[model samples]
Target: MIIISTLVFFALLLIGLDVGFSMILAALIGMVLRSGAGIDPVMAPMTLVSSVDSVALITIPMFVLAGEIMNRGGVTRRLIDWSAAMVGHFRGSLSQVSIMTNFIMSGITGSAVADATATGSILIPEMKKEGYKPGYASAVVAAGSMLGPILPPSIPMILYAVMANLSVLRLFLAGVVPAILLCAGYMVICGIIARRRDYRAREKASWGTRIKVTRASIWALMMPLLIIGGIRSGLITDTEAAGMICVYALVIGLFVYRDLKYKDLGAVFYHAGRTSAVILFLLAAAGPFAWLLSESHIATAISQAILSISTDHFTVLVVVNLLLLAVGMILEPLPALVMFVPTLLPIQAQLGIDPIHFATVVIVNLMIGMLHPPVGLLVFVTSAIGRTPIWSVAVEVLPFLGWSIVVLILISAFPGLVVWLPNLVMK
Candidate 1:
């Protein structure tokens, strides 16, 4: 029944229906077929309401609004300047700056598509002007955007924690090491490609210039500290932190930077509201869908299928990772998490994996999906912005994809790398 419902959901998606509607309808179909499962198809409407009832879910809009405000408020330009000043001396300097800006923006937006649009719009043109292939430039931005959901204050992490009943703080802390590793790894890849392509490097900024650039971005830089500090110190809950950041972004964009105008508020709020509504609706619809999956004993079936092959923890972990990777390739991250996490929780516990560790792996794996097809939103954003062929950009993204898998394998094999920071800080 779960499988049948999932296929229906996919067919609807492929036919151009919105994910939220598709999920709700698919779940409704399942309930109709299995009307004896103790859950009525009629209750589907109620499930939609109850799914988004959690207080933690409020952060979704707040964080998204903050990101929208930052994009409009001139934070993007300041971060770009700071990035170029700091790393422009390196080979393929523009590409390096794109990744660096995305790294900083990750903390601010906690979103991949926003980071890609914000940074890609600015850097992709500059890279092309600097003689880098447009496709390569877009691919770099697409690859770098994956960092958005792996860093602290990530919206996806918040949603994942909300659904998994895991600690948001622990998940935030767990993201630290993985974020750093990815940032460093991406820069290294850019450097190697730059060296091979004979990409020109920029002049190293003078000490005075570097200091000035750093000073300019100081307020923007403080945004992340404000978010992480408030949350880690228990000064605020995650949703409260989201609200604080949105307020903080507004102040900086209005009074501080003065680039965001009073007139812009209407459009900014509208965009945020629209994006948030889509995600929230998907969360609501996925509730009934996930419940139906649970009622179908999908988790038990999957567990049995995996154990039938090998019950060894290591082998089971590999199989689970592959399953998630495949799932991610097909679904966007939010819907994927909402629909799949419940079905996997039992398998995770039986495999003796730490919740935070498993959560980190799941987040990273789904984020990689953003760089893939046929629903790779990150790739589409960059490709559209750079005006490059989508296939060309996708092909250029292959190396990063391969390297990302390596990082995925590392974290999967060594759980402590992900969980250690959370344990130390949140203990």
Candidate 2:
């Protein structure tokens, strides 16, 4: 029953079915076939609706709305300009700007798609004009945009924290060092590639230009600090911080930057609403599919399989990373999280792994999956923007992908690297 149900889930996904509905229908099939094994069809609807009952879930729409406002309000433009001025003098300067811009944008827009599309549209052309290959330009955007979900205010981390019954702030904190590490890895790869390709560096900005650009982006730069500081100081919960972010972005968009008009509110709300609705529905459907996996004891089987090979901590961590990476190659991160957080989270505790460490590893692995075939959202966005073939873009992104794996390994092997910031701050 488990094997057949698993196949149906992936089969539905491969056929271009929407992931949420695919999970729901696949789950219905699982219940009907495995009803004797404590899977009840009648409970599926209840599970779907009830899955989104938490107050923490309120943060999704708020953050989504904030991101939309920032994107539409000229915020993305200012952020990009600032990053370019500050870092575009380096070897592979444009590539460095892409990474730095995405790192900043990650705080405002936690969605990888948002980062990829917003930054890719602006920078891919600029990079190409500067003599970068279209495929490599697209590749840089796809790789750098991944920082969106790894940094604070990340949407994926919110989902994982809620599912794992962990603190949202702590999970956000846990991502800090790894986010820096990933950026460093990406920059190192960017530098090496730049040297090989002889990518030209821009003239260093005059101090006056740097100061002027930085001053112009002051409000944009304060955003992440405001959200993270507010939450870390215990002045607001994640949901409150999100609401504050929404209001702050709106004010900045309407008054400060004056890029967003009152007339644009309707479209902003509509788009944000649609995006939020899709995620909530996926979360709802995931409840039953995940429940079905639990009833079938798939987690236990996988856990036992790992232990059979070896009980050593490093060996187990490696095996688990491999499994999640495999799951990521097929399913989008959210659905994969829905199905397996229940499955592997318990196993993580059983092995004495830290939840924050495990959460960071799982989220990062799935995100890296976003750069490759089948369902890499980042690759598709950048490819379309750069007018490059997805196949070619995928090839160009390989080096960044390899460096990301090294960062993943660092976090997985050294729990202290992942947990120390959160432990220090939260304590």
Candidate 3:
């Protein structure tokens, strides 16, 4: 039954079916088959709704809405300009901006797709104007935008926390260093590539101009501070912090900057809703699939598989990272987290791994999946924005992808790098 259901799920997914529907349909078919074969299937419906019933789940849409508001409200432009002024004079400066912008914006909004949409639209054109190949530009955007989901306030962390029954706050704290490491990795790679290609730097702007640009972006810069502060001070739950972000973006967009208007609200809401619908639908459908997996004791099977391969902590970590990265290439972030968190948490604990650290590494690996061929969401977004072919985008994204994968391995091997921040801050 499990084999049949799993095959059906993959078959549907390969045919371009919505991931959520594929999961749910596969699980429902599994349930029917099991029940007809004289097994009780009463747990199916319960698990389906239970999965989506998480209070943590509410944060997803709020974060999605906040991200949309920020993107449309000119927050993205400010971030681009600020990063550009700071780094754009270097060879391949625009690519650097994409890396820095990803690092900075990741704190404000945790969705990788949102980050890509917000940053790529503005930066891609500038990179092209600055002599970057369109493929490189698309690649940089797709790769860098992944930073958002690995940083604090990340949606994937929330999902992982909920599924693993781990502390979201600690997970958020743990992600800080790894996110910075990923950003630095990308910047270094871009620098080397830029130098090799003889990419010329933009003419230096006056210090006064740079200061003006920074001052102009101060409001935008405060966003990350606000989110981190709210979370650390216990002033707001993660969900509330998400709401606060929406409010902040609203004030900045509709009133402060005066770029977003009443008419724009409708469009922003519609787009946000569309994005939210896709995510929520995935969640809703994944619920049944998760239940099915639990029923079939897939988690036990996974745990046993890991233990059989090697009980050595380092070996287990390597194996798990590779497995998740492969799964991430095919499944979207939410489903992947939901499916694996339960299965892996016991193994992580037994291996003496910190749940928070493990979650950070998992999310980071999954974000890299966003750079993979066939279904990398960020790659598609960049391709659409840059009007480049997907194949071109995929080829260019390889370097960034390589950097991210190395960073993932580093995080997996050296768990303290991820846990250090949480140990300091949460202690």
Candidate 4:
């Protein structure tokens, strides 16, 4: 039954079915066959409702709405200007600017697709005009945009927390150091490339200009601090932080920036709703599929199989990373999270690995997958927005990919990188 269900799921995906629906169909078949009875209609709806009933889930849409408002509200322009002013005097200024902009935007949006779309639209063209190769420009955008999930207030971290029965706040904190490391790693690679390619730096900005740009972007920068600080200070729940950020973003967009008008709000809400719905649907479908695996003891079976191979924690960790890297290449992170995290949680316990560390590693792996070719969502997004060919963008992303893998290995080998911030803050 498991073999058949797995085949059906992949087959549906191959035929271009929506991931949410494909998961549901495959699960339904498995449930019916395993029960040796016709499908129990109550099971599907019950699973979905239970999966989404959590108050924690509300943050997903709130964060989505916040990102939408910020994007349309002219926040991206301010962020870009601020990043350029701060780093434009350095060699590879544009590349450095792209990385810094992604870091700031990651705090605001927490969605790599949104980040790639927003940043690529603005910076890719500018980079090309400034003599950067289109492929390299697009590659930088795609690679840096991945910071969205690795930074705090991330939707993927929230989902992983709920799935693993871990603390959302802790998971959010856990990502901080690793995210900073990745940003630094990207900047180092960018600097090297800049020197080799002789990319020119802009004249240093005057203090007057720097102050003006900083003043303009201060409010935009405050959004992440407010969310993270409020949560860490115990002044607000994660959901409340998300809601407050949404309201703040709306006000900044409609009144302060004046870029997002009342009329534009409808489209913003519509887009947020659409993106949120897809995620919720995927979560709902994943509930049943995950339940089936647990019910059939498939998760335990896999755990036992791994333990049989080797009991050494490092060996097991390495093996699991390889498996996740392969799975990430083919699957979107959300669905992949739903399908695999449950199965791996048992193995995680057997090895006594920290949940927060495992979650961080899983997210980093999946984010890297977003850069891989063929099905990499961000690859397509950057290519289309930058007007670069997918092949060229893929080729250009190779160096950034190598850098990301190095960070992944470092984080995995030293779990302290993923856990120290969480421990200090949460304790």
Question: Model 4, residue 94: what's the lDDT?
Answer: 92
Which ranges in model 1 have alpha carbons more than 4 Å from their true place? Answer: 36-38
How displaced is residue 315 in candidate 4, in Å? 1.8
Tell me how candidate 2 scores on lDDT: 0.89
Clashing pairs in 1: none
Residue 297 in candidate 4, Cα distance off native in Å: 1.1
lDDT of 1: 0.88
Q: Per-residue error at 185 for model 3, in Å?
A: 1.5
TM-scores of the candidates are: 0.97, 0.97, 0.95, 0.97
> Against the correct fold, how does model 1 do in TM-score?
0.97
Question: Which scores higher on TM-score, 1 or 3?
Answer: 1
lDDT of each: 0.88, 0.89, 0.82, 0.89
| Residue runs of model 3 more than 4 Å from their true location after superposition | 36-42
Model 4 per-residue lDDT tens digits across residues 1-427? 8778889999999999988888888888888887765446458678878888888999999999999999999999999999999988888999999999999999999999999999999999999999999999999999999999988779899898888788888888888898898899889889989999999999999999999999999989998889889988899998999999999998999889899999998899999999999888889989778877877789999889888889787678878889888998789888898899988898889889988998899889888889887678888899999888999999988988888888889988999999999898878
Q: CA RMSD for every model?
A: 1.3, 1.3, 1.7, 1.4
* Alpha carbon lDDT at 177, candidate 2: 93
Judge candidate 3 at residue 363 and give its lDDT.
83
